[model samples]
Target: FCFKILNFPAEHIMHMAIGTSLSIILVTVTNSMYAHHLNKNIDWNISKKMFFAIVIGALAGGFVSKDLAAKTLEIIFSVYVTLVSIKMLMDVKVERDPKATKDVFYWTVGFIIGFKSTILGIGGGTISIPFLTWRGLPMKKAVGISASLGIPIAMAGVASYIYNGMKISNLPEYSMGYIYLPALVGVVLTSSFFARIGAKLSHNLDQQKLKKAFAIFLMLIALKIFIG
Candidate 1:
């Protein structure tokens, strides 16, 4: 729906809003379910922090005008995020502290994940998972918590996009702002199922290998966006 929205008639802002809203709803629901069924021991404090970061980041990212400048920013940010993902993957080490304080490290990690998630369509797991594991949480626990944390990130990011989209002038038809319903529906329906499968598979894989694979996938997507 997002891609369609990009090409939709300039007068359909409401449609775009609807599509973005629906996409976020779907993302949240799927993430919640994954958390419940897969990771039942989430740390509420960390989850709350991550959620707040998502909201702030989404609000900021969503408000940017959809112009040549915005597209440029998107490409630049994508490359930066992809590099960060690769760095995290390469520097993987087993975390030894599970009850660490909410210090500078925690906030820095959370902010990066939230900001990148807002710019990209991802749920922030690509960054969150490795950070959590590096902070000492078990891989299963990190995945579960990250999945849960993703709900708020999607909600806030989509909401921001929808809200800002409503204010866009001369937007395309069948768009609410930056959203396109049909595309959103298709992606959500397909991605949700695949995300669940991925979550399940994470449990059976080697943590380091999984992180590297995810990092590579993120980098590829970033390159695609940059080239597009």
Candidate 2:
């Protein structure tokens, strides 16, 4: 929404992003449940570990983001999203029944991902999937776990953006804090169904093929954001 769909300023766009994130919970939940029932590979334990850290990080990021320069935030966002592209391009092997690294390691990763995700108004999958894979999770399970953890990021972003945006008196119409009602409604109506399809495809396809596709997709997004 930089220069393409909308022309809102960075901070305001972040609020819009947080609002859009609210619908992602549906997609993530659907993804997790399907993965658990059909694939039997959902990592609820690691998801639990990441939840607390993400909430705290997202809450803090809302405030910290206001102090950051837009250009700086853009650079940070571009750099991290691109990590997924690079990691996937490398074709890293997926570990079977891999044990999660350590609590401290995940906690650290969770916080950083949460902070950046909130500030950038992202869903966190780009960071979450890559991190999970880096620590040995198979691609399918990594996608499920990443989707599971998206709930906390969305919840925290919604609350944070709502709270932070309340103090500003100059926001546009049909607005609650920073979230635009029209966009939220539109996203909520459609994102879940597509997300479910995406989850299903992730399971049915060859992971190597998935990696190549996902890598290219992320690269395009990073370039788009960076160019804007």
lDDT winner: 2
TM-score, cand. 1 vs. native:
0.74
List the lowest-lDDT window of 10 residues for candidate 2. 18-27
Give stretches of model 2 more than 4 Å off.
2-11, 22-38, 94-100
Candidate 1: where is the Cα deviation over 4 Å?
A: 1-29, 32-38, 64-68, 103-112
Tens-digit lDDT track of model 2 for 109-223: 8998788778877767777877787777877677778777777887787777777778877666777886777776676567656666766776678878877887899899889
Each model's lDDT comes to 0.63, 0.72
lDDT of 1: 0.63
Top-TM-score candidate index:
2
Q: Model 1: per-residue lDDT, tens digit, 137-188?
A: 8877776777776776667667766676778676656655567656666667
